[model samples]
Target: MSTATAIDADAAPWSPAQPVLEVRGLNVDYGAGRDAVRAVNEVTFTLRRGEVLGLAGESGSGKSTLAYAITRLLRAPGVITGGEVVFHQPSASGGPARTVDLLAADARELAGIRWVDLSMVFQSAMHALNPVARIEGQLTDVLKRHRPDMAPAERRARAIELLGMVGITPDRLSSYPHELSGGMRQRVMIAMALALEPSLVIMDEPTTALDVVTQREILDELMRLRERLGFAVIFITHDLSLLLELADTIAIMYAGQLVESAAAADLLAAPRHPYSLGLLNSFPALHGERVKMTGIPGSPPSLRAMPTGCKFHPRCPHAFERCSAEQPALLTPAGSRGKRTVACWLQTGDRVPPEPLGRPEGDRSQDLAVGGH
Candidate 1:
C-alpha cells in the first residue's frame, strides 16, 4: 500500500481540466406503482483522472445500483428517474475542456462513447465472460465492436498485447474462460474493460470472489495499471480495510443515500457519520494484530420502507429523540480543509451532546486519533 497522503484541498486534484466523470443527484428506482423502491437516492460523486474512489457499504446499500446507473446498464424495472451522469471527453484541440451530459446522449452518441470512453468490470467475472469463446475471441470482440476499422489480424495482435498488459501470457489467448483461474479471469475482464482505453472504469466488487492472497495481488496489479494508464476508477465494495489500502477517497452508503465521503486516510482516522464509524470498526485490520470484530448489528433497512429522519438512526447507537423526526442534510466539517462530507444530525448541531457510547473490546484510544469525536 502506498503511504502517499491524499491530495489536500489546496491541491484540488479534481480540476476542471482533469475531470473524467461527474454524477449529480442521481436517483434510480426499481419496480413500479406501489411496489416501486428507490434504490439510489440523490447520490452524487465525481471521478477525477487517475483517482480511485471506493464506494463502501453493506448489502442493499445501493452501491451497486449507483454503479449500474452510472454505466447506463440498469435493466427493466430499474429506471434512472433523476440526475445527470456527465462524461467529459477531450476535445480535438487538445485543450483540457471537453463535452458533457452522457445521460441525454442518443444511442448513436452512446455507441461512439461506451467502452471507448467508459467501461465496467462487473462483480461476477466468470459469468461475465463467454464460456464457449476463447480468450482471444472474447477480447477481440470488444475491439471489433468499438474499432471496426481494425482487421482480424490486427485485432488478434491487440488481443495478445492486452492479455500481456494484464499479466497473462500471450499463449493463454487460446484458452477458454473455463480454462483460466478465477484471478486470471478477473484480470482478463479488466483487460477487456481497458481494451478501448476508456477514460473511466467502474469496478463493482472486483475482488470479492478471490482468496486473500489473490485479492491482494489483483488489487496491487490494478493500482499499478492505474498508475500506468492514468484513468479514473470507481471501486465498489463492502470491505473497508481493502478500500483503505486501495482507494484515494472513500464514500460510505447507507440505505439509498451516500452518508459520508472523505479521503481514505481522513475517513479511517476520523469518520463523521455513525454508520461510517461502525463500518470502520467492523473490519479486522490486515497488517495490525487480529481483534474481535464487532460486525454492525441489524440488517440494512428495506428501500421500500426506509426509516424517516436519518435512515441509519434505527440501528445507530447514538440516535436521539430528534433523529426520528428530522432528516439530516449532507454537510462539510466546520473547519475541515478538504471535501469531507457527512450526512448526520450530530455534525449539524441539532441536539444536545449525549454521553459517549461504551467502547468495543479491542478499542484503543489511539485508534480514534484521526477522526476525533
Candidate 2:
C-alpha cells in the first residue's frame, strides 16, 4: 500500500498506457543470513494501467512469492531482501498524481492504501472468507473500516450494490459462506475485493478449485468488471492456455526467475525460452488436431540446491555448454520488434535457436522438445 488516492471511476479517466505498478530488482528470501533460501530472484516488471498481466509457471516457480512480496504481504520466514515496488496513483480531484514506494510504507500508510487503492483476491474463496460471518457483514465490514465517513445505511447500500455487481442478490447477504455454492462464494470474494474500487487487483489463482465452466464464468465476470472499473490486474496462474486468452501480456517464471515475457499473442505464437516452449507444449491445443501432451523432463530445482548458470538448464532440452557455464540475462532478441525479452542462451547469445522461435499458430505438431519425456 502507498500514500496514493483512489482513482474515481466517474471523474478521473484512466491512462491505460501509463505505468501503474513498477517492480524493480525484487528479491525475496525464505530465511535470514546463511539459512536464507531465495524464492524470488531479482524479478522486475511493469504493469500498465487497465492491463491484464498474467504470470504463469510451474508450481514452484515463485509466482505467489513474487505477488506477496510486491504487495508487502510476505510473512514470517519470508523476507524481501531488495527492490522497489513503486505505485503511481492518480489523484481523485483533478490534481497531480502521487507516487510512493510500497516497500517503505509504514503500517498506518499501508492501512490507508489497502482495499482503497489496491486489493487482492486470494487463491481460495472459502479460505479467504469468514465462515461464521454473514456475507453482508463481510462485505460491509470493509466499507465500515475504510470509509469511516460513511453512515451505516450507506455502507449497507454499497454492500448490496457490490454484491449485485458480482451477480449476487441482496437476499443472500444474510447467508454464511457455507450456505453458498463454490461459485457464489468466489463471486463474494471478488465482490469484496471490488467494494472499494481499487486501482489494481492481484488475483492469485482465484478459480483454481472450481470447474472449468465456473472458471470461465468467473473470468468473464472479471473481464467485464475490469472494463467497467478500469483497473489493472496481475493474474497469477499456471494455466498457459487460459492466460493466452485472458491476458494482454504474459510473464513466465522458472526457479524463482523470469525466463520470458512478451505480449500474450506473441508469446503464444512464439515463446523464445526453451522452458517456456516446454510449458506451452505441455498443454493440449485449444483448436487443432490432437497432439500428445508432453511434460518438461524433470521437476523444478529445490531453492537451496539451484543449479548454476541458467536455473532451467538441467531440465531444458536446448541446454548447451554455454548454458551450463554462464548465466544469461534477460534481453531483447537481435531482430525482435516489440518489448519481448527472454533469458536464454539460444536467443541472447550469438547462437540462434534451433528453429524459428515459434511454430505456425494453431499448429501443435511441431513442438520445441526434441525428445519425448
Candidate 3:
C-alpha cells in the first residue's frame, strides 16, 4: 500500500513546533507477489523532546515494525512503501528549525545522523553484542566511528565513564558479554546507546527478559538518564503496568494500526477505546485485591488478510452493523486530555450497546499476575 492512500481519514495534521520526531502515513510491506503483507498501516505519532512515548500492543501488533521503519533498518523482504519520518534539528542562532525526512535520506545522510543524532537499544542485548569483542571495544566503537578525531586514550576514558553512567563499574569493561548477567548486559546496551547523547532513542522491550527487581532498577535508571540528557524516547513493549511508571504518553496499537493515543494518566484513568480498556483490565494492580483478570477474546488478525471495514470490528466489544460495514477513523473524543485520539465506532458517536467481545478460553489470571499484564 502507498503511504498517501493508507492514511486514516481523521489523522491529525503535522506541525514541526511541537514534535521532535514525527511519523506521517507510514506503511511497511513484506514480499512482492500477491501474497504481500502490510505490516504497518498509516501509523502516525509524535515524540516530544524529554518525553517518553509508550507504544503498547501484543507480539504481532506491528509496534516493532514501526520502530525499525523509523530508523530505516527494515530487511530485504520488508520495504517501506511510503510515509515520512521527519526529525527536527535545532537551528544555529535563533533561526527556524531544519527538518530531515528519514525515508528519503541517502546512505551518506543516514550515516551523518544515525547514532550521532539517533540511537536504538534492541530487545535482546546478548544477541546485539559481539561475542568476541570486549565491552570496552564495543563501547568505544561508537565513539570511534562518530567522533574519529578523538585520541585512543580519550575514547577509552569515555567508555569507562559511560559504563559508570549506567551504574556498571569501569573494570567490567574488560569482560565479555558471556561474563555478565542478563541484566548487566542490558545495562551495557543502554550505556552504548546513550554514549553519543542522541536527541532520540528507540527501545524495543529493553527490560522484557530481566526479572522484576532488575527491570525496575533499569527503568529507574533510564528515567534518571532521560532527565539528565533531555532526549525523547520511543519505548515499545507489551507491558502496560511498567509503562505507567515510565511513559509520559501512551499509544495503543491493534491489527497493525494505532487504536488510541493519549496522555498516560488520562489513558489509565479513562480509555476511550474498548480495546484499550480491555488491555488495562487484563493487568493485576499492585493495590487492588486478587481478581480474575480478563484477557481480550480474540487474537490479532493476520496482516495479509485483514478484515473488511474496521480491522478491529470482529473483536471490538462495542462493534455494530455499521462497524462491520464502515471503518472508523482516528478522531478526537470529547473530554480528551491534551491531544487524545481514538479510532473506534463508539468514540465516533455510535449508539450501539456494549456486548461481550468473546474472552480467551482458560484461566489466564496467573499468567497476568506473573507477566505484569
Q: Which structure among the candidates has the greatest lDDT?
A: 2
Question: Of 2 and 3, which scores higher on TM-score?
Answer: 2
Clash count for each candidate, listed in order shown: 3, 0, 0
Q: By the lDDT metric, which is better: model 2 or model 3?
A: 2
Q: Which rank order by lDDT, best down to worst? A: 2, 3, 1
Report how far off residue 313 is in candidate 1 (Å): 0.4
lDDT of 2: 0.84
lDDT of 2 by residue, 339-363 (tens): 8889888885487577646433344
| lDDT, each prediction | 0.80, 0.84, 0.80
Which residue pairs show backbone clashes in model 3?
A: none
Which candidate number maximizes TM-score?
A: 2
TM-score attained by model 1: 0.88
User: In candidate 1, what are the lDDT values of residues 107-186, reduced to their tens digit?
Assistant: 66676777887889989989999999999999999888888899999999999988888789999999999999999999
Cα error, candidate 2, residue 261 (Å): 0.4
lDDT score of residue 178 within candidate 3: 97
10 residues in a row with least lDDT, candidate 3? 355-364
RMSD of each: 7.0, 4.2, 6.6
Q: What is the alpha-carbon lDDT of model 1 when measured against the actual structure?
A: 0.80
